[model samples]
Target: MCLLAFQLQKHPKYKLIMMANRDEAYNRPTTPADFWSDYPDILAGRDLEQMGTWLGINKQGKIAALTNHRDFSLPETGGQSRGHIVSSYLQSNETPEDFLEQLHNSKNEYSGFNVLVGSSEELYYYSNIEQKTEHLKNGTHGLSNAFMNTPWPKTEAVKKLLCDYAESTNEIDVDVLFNMMQRAERFPSEQLPDTGVGGELESMLSSIFIASKEYGTRCTTVLLVDSEDQVYFEERTFKNGVFATAQKFSFTIENPTA
Candidate 1:
């Protein structure tokens, strides 16, 4: 996931909402959102090439997402796939804080990454480049590859939208969030982060909205986890190189003892 926006709360009907876009080379093999036969509790797009995923959730109410660091000039330190870092954490028995601590201590195990991991009681963020891992301070927050809440174009736009919607106190709606994402724009040259990555940065961020270009949004995913622990997962793909193919799922948790 390259861009992610989320709202976390203690509300009764909905507790968490997330919208993100996953950017990658088109040729990479992947399976769209579905129940993994091998791991029935897991629902996400699986990267066949890397055996990892950008975003995913488990039946146990564990949610995880990852994005690569934008520093393209950094020396290639061949390391573990960051996506697997998220998956491994979700599959573990540790709490979010514990998991983040472990991740911070093992930063050398992978390339730079921004990871979000949480269950019902805890939310945590970890960046290998910062060498810091801690629970998210309450309130709205957005993160991309650059840094936490650095005002990247997409992050800023989403933050504003989420703030507006949140202020309305309306039942959280995923469609409205999706529309906002579809309308998000790339940052103008002056607004682009000085990653030193140069031109490719422009291409990656700008191409998403340019019709003449072959790039834009690769996949858009929206997830809503209600206070009742019900999770709604929705994904839209641009096929034939351009256009949205819609898909959605709602995973409800039933109190087995009841």
Candidate 2:
């Protein structure tokens, strides 16, 4: 996931509400969100190149999402595919704390990346850039290519939008969340962060919904886990920056707990 905003245990009717967009090259082959035949319980869009996923969830209510950290100055170090980290966490029997501990030891094996792993009731956030895991508090949070909640223009904007929507609404609306993630307006050039990528590229990526020729948002996913443990997951795939298809799934998590 390239950009995401989520509220954890904050809303009245929902346990967790999240909206995310996955950005990638136009030619990268990908499969829309679905239950993998190999990993029956896992549901997520697959990056065909590496057979890994940026975000995913399982029947046991395990949730995981990842974003790569942008740094051009770093030397070329071929590391493990970061997407596998999400898939690995979802498939693991270990708790978030334990899994993160193990990941910290092998952090250098992967390129810089940020990840959120756990269930709706309790979640943990970690970034290889920081090398620490945070027991996410019950509140709104946002993350993007940088670190978690770094207040990059788009991150703060999306975070506030979620906070307002959750405060005004009593029930979760998948469509509303999707619309929020669809904003493509670019922030002013002066407001864009200099992540080592040149000015032109940085300006293009300033938008919450990136739309460029060769690379842009491939899909948008909105996931809601209500207090009753009902999971609503919807993904809209795009073709050349245009909506192509959408897939929706609903399930009641088995034995949901903190």
Candidate 3:
């Protein structure tokens, strides 16, 4: 997940609302989002190359998502698959705090990455690059390659859009969220971050929906949990930023025993 925007605990009729786009190489092999056969409770797309996932949820009402943090100094083969960090949380019964506290010791083994885990009711953010973890407040937030809500042009733009979505209605308009992902507006060169990558490359990656011949936006996903505790997950996959397919899954979050 290169770009992520979400509104939590701020909507009248929803517990959480989120929209994200995963950017990857056009040639990389990936499976569309689905309930894993081995871990049938887990729902997410598989990174075939690593047998992990960038984002996922389980029947236990657990949610987890991961985004790579750009760091040129790190070797391509960092200790572990960052995707596995997300997949691991989905399969475990640990609370986000406990899970991350354990990972703190070994986080250095992984490549630069930021991770979010816990149910919508109690989300937590941690980045190995920043070496910090904190409970996300109830409000709109964004994440990209740098850090949580670093005000990157794309992050700031979509955060406002997501904020509107959260405040707009009793339920989110999936279409509105989907269309926002199609934004291709490139940030001006001067406004882009210089994270070691050259200005030319940064500009190309500035858009919410990227379109490069070798690499681009791979999928757009919208996830929501309503006031009644219904969960909806949708994904639209693409090839070079062109829509290729879409998938949807729905469930209800079981209430805790009194």
RMSD of each: 3.0, 1.0, 1.8
Compose the digit string of candidate 1's lDDT tens values, residues 1-258. Answer: 777877777444667778887777666677787877877877888788878888888877788889888786775544788778866875677777778888888888887788988854456888888888767765677877777787777677787887788767758777787777776345578666766667665645642222224444567888887766788889887653465577788877543110
Q: Candidate 3: lDDT of 209?
A: 89
* Highest-scoring model, lDDT: 2
**Candidate 3: segments with Cα more than 4 A from true spot:** 73-77, 255-258
Q: For candidate 2, lDDT tens digit of each residue in 170-210?
A: 97778888888889999999888888989999999989998
Error (Å) of candidate 2 at residue 22 is: 0.2
Quote model 2's TM-score.
Answer: 0.98
Which lDDT value does model 1 have at 107?
Answer: 85
1 against 3, candidate with superior TM-score: 3
Off by over 4 Å in 1: 10-12, 203-216, 254-258
Report the poorest 10 consecutive residues by lDDT, candidate 3. 249-258
- Per-model lDDT: 0.73, 0.92, 0.87
TM-score of every model versus the real structure: 0.89, 0.98, 0.96
Q: 1 or 2, which is superior by TM-score?
A: 2
After the best TM-score superposition of candidate 3, give how far the Cα of residue 113 lies from its true spot, in angstroms: 0.4
Poorest stretch of ten by lDDT in candidate 1: 206-215
